[model samples]
Target: MMMRPPLVEVRGMTKRFGALTALDDVSLRLAPGAFHAILGENGAGKSTLVKCMMGYHRADAGRLLVDGQEHQVAGPRGAHHLGFGMVYQHFTLVPSMTVAENLILGRDDLPAVVAWAAERERMEAFLRRMPFRVDLDRAAGALAAGEKQKIEILKQLFLGRRVLILDEPTSVLTPDEADQILGVLRTMAREGQVTVVLITHKFREVEAFAHEVTVLRAGRRIGGGHVKDLTRGDLVAMMIPPMLAVEALTVLDDKALTAVRELSLAVGAGEILGVAGVSGNGQRELVETLAGQRSPEAGLIRVAGERYRPTRRQMRRRRVFVLPEEPLSNACVRTMTIAENLAFRNFDEPPIAVTGGFLSRRALHDRGRELIDRFKIRAAGPDASLDTLSGGNVQRTVLARELSQSPKVLVAQNPCAGLDVAATAEIRGRIMAARNAGAAVLFLSEDLDELMELADRIVVMFEGRLVYETARAAADPHVIGHSMASHL
Candidate 1:
């Protein structure tokens, strides 16, 4: 038997922004009911290509074929009308509205004298049919990220979209929650209920659910193949080249409701120690304590044979740096210029400030220029406001500011949390460089694959305690997952 034509097809898709060609002669054919995955590092054309498909962007050159019929999607609404649905990384639900109300908010086909009671019953039946566990009467804001995500999927399903596009859907979910969400999507695709186009950086997600893979690099299609036909190494080689490894470290956060308890570990010089766990498992408290954002109340932290409190002055004197998660909120003053933000750590002393306590404008700009070039920060200029930069650029600025100090002990908590593949690689590369330069690095993240690749040793955190530890080479995802779930 012959295969049916692709449910969605793009021919010679090309898009350009000024001198940057975001997409060049890109073409894709997504089969009906196939869990198609688009993988690429940051600055790759994955987002661009998807935007074109969703009508959020208009291609400069190309044709989009839906069900063998050429069509131009005018905008997001038009895409929705054309049986294409997209769920963004950030939710679009209204906080005050009930899940049922949020679901039908934008729809206009409802009866003039609407029966909310009957509607609720109908929604309940529909939810039960799909076997979704969301409480329709609850406010959308009150639900967890996973439940809100399910509501988004159900809304799209209710609209009868044949193709569902999810952008980093499980980035915030726990291991168990992520598995459940992806399993549902995979089942839907396998049962011919919908076609899935997942845009993500996690190779594990692709391996777990995707059937076909398309890889892009630097705004062009680099490779494409069936999931079973390729290896994880192949995917990494195409997406992000591996970085150098790091050592082991530990910590205990006192005042724990149930989080950190008697934690003690050590990281070697020129090594990275990776801490992995499900969110809310004492990771936050540990990072806060290590970064000096919170006092440990009681617990000894030793660095290079000296007990330390990780106070700001002690950290600065010791040449230690902390790359806290969400740098925009925690590390930067958005209203300030790029140069000003870069000077935040050292403005009180020379280079940024002179002996007379006067700010050195020239020195600041000069250093900013050097770091922007060295870190490949995409900014208008040092004078540009910090808020004007993109997510990747913001991260680049953070990395440049921290690593330029030549830190002896670097504590980075989810440094690549919201970054793209390229930005993440750059940050990880700098961390490895720090390790190689005799720095003891603490690399903490929820992304297991990242830790496995960048860490020489790994430790799992459960309810604020160190439940499991192993060398990177001997680490197993299943064992780690079990530990994360508090089952070990």
Candidate 2:
């Protein structure tokens, strides 16, 4: 009898970032034509482990075997050399470029003229296999989020990728879009196309799509086994959650806190009402409305006893600040220097016009130094591009800039998702500090653990409405879990 070869095998993989240990002797196996899911909590080693597999970060110690042969991948190109491709949470597609341009970015065989014909042929062929259809000539940026994902898929298809690593592929996708992508994945499997390593926090996704599942906690591989053998509760227990530890007696001030926080259309000033739902609930809309970025019909916003609807200018004047769920806010461009972005938020003197009509080098660098030192952000230097910073550091920069605004109401969503342990602790502390400083924090998060741990009062958001606000002590994980699932 002959033994079957595993599609990909990782053994004793370890990665360290100075004092932080992200992956510790972790290992995983992916079989051919299998949909494998990697699960973990917010600060777990899932992201780091996938990084090692993708060849973006080299493992301190590990052996990788593909098709029973050893493989050494130094970077994305090296991984591509070994027939592995990746679809990141954030895409790499150029919004202005057409689909064909993105597909044949670095291939040698397809020359400039031939590239167009070859890409178009390949794009149509791959589109036939996929569930969704996209115009091959359309600019990627104009496509919907789901359609853009199809282009990402086509890029891999053009490269003839065999093993694919998807990092939080559905985070930005709507439910319908998620369904379409998963369907395409299943079609690929039915046709014996490729193997997938899905990195996600969605518990239900594993139960539905995965053939085999691997769960990681902290920086260690805790369990790996058949998916059919586990229950949802079993999976949750495997994640090793931390205790809430909030006592009823911990409340110092509950004057504005109502037993049931009424959240119909109007909420008052100096009210730090919290919104807690499962990760993908429609909390995104409710906050955007109050933040003055999105307009709501038939809704009136009253600030400090003055009644008027929210406007961009009004939100500007009222000091309304919004902290986006994703670490990099639209306000912070990842490519720009840190000081340049930070200067915009500092909001001090008149904007200085320099020799190049850009930010003054010395002024930006000095301000960047102050913010990084003050926030303990990990950065090479003040001049470093924001993209070089880790997810945690980028988040810290955004927090520092927003908090510097000292707003009347802080409307924040998922302020700590994908952050490291130290960063998560630090960012959460800052939000609480903001509340202590008398700024009303409209905290929103899908991680019920975070919402419960940080919020003074919690409101359950299902679909697009605020359902209820349970006191921190009275909240039940099961109940919150049910409400979050209700929207779906």
Measured by lDDT, the strongest candidate is 1
TM-score of structure candidate 1: 0.50
Query: Any runs in candidate 2 off by more than 4 Å, and if so which?
Result: 1-6, 106-115, 242-488
| Tens-digit per-residue lDDT, 1-488, candidate 1 | 11222489989999999999999998889888899999988778898999999999999999999888999888887787778888888888999999888888756365667688887877777776685777778999999988988888888877666788998888878888888988988987887778899999889999999999998877778787999999996786577422221112333445435456667666766778899988878787777777777655456776654577677788788777888888899889999999888877788877678877798899999888888999999999999999999988898898888888898888888988878888888888989998999887888899999999999789988776778999899999899988888746
lDDT of each: 0.82, 0.72
Top candidate when judged by TM-score against the true structure: 1
Per-model TM-score on C-alpha atoms: 0.50, 0.48
- Writing each residue's lDDT as its tens digit, candidate 2 over 367-421 gives 7788889888888887889889888888888887778767776778887888778
Candidate 2 vs. true structure, TM-score? 0.48
Once fitted onto the true fold, the runs of candidate 1 whose alpha carbons sit more than 4 angstroms away are 1-6, 108-113, 241-488
lDDT value, residue 218 of candidate 1:
72
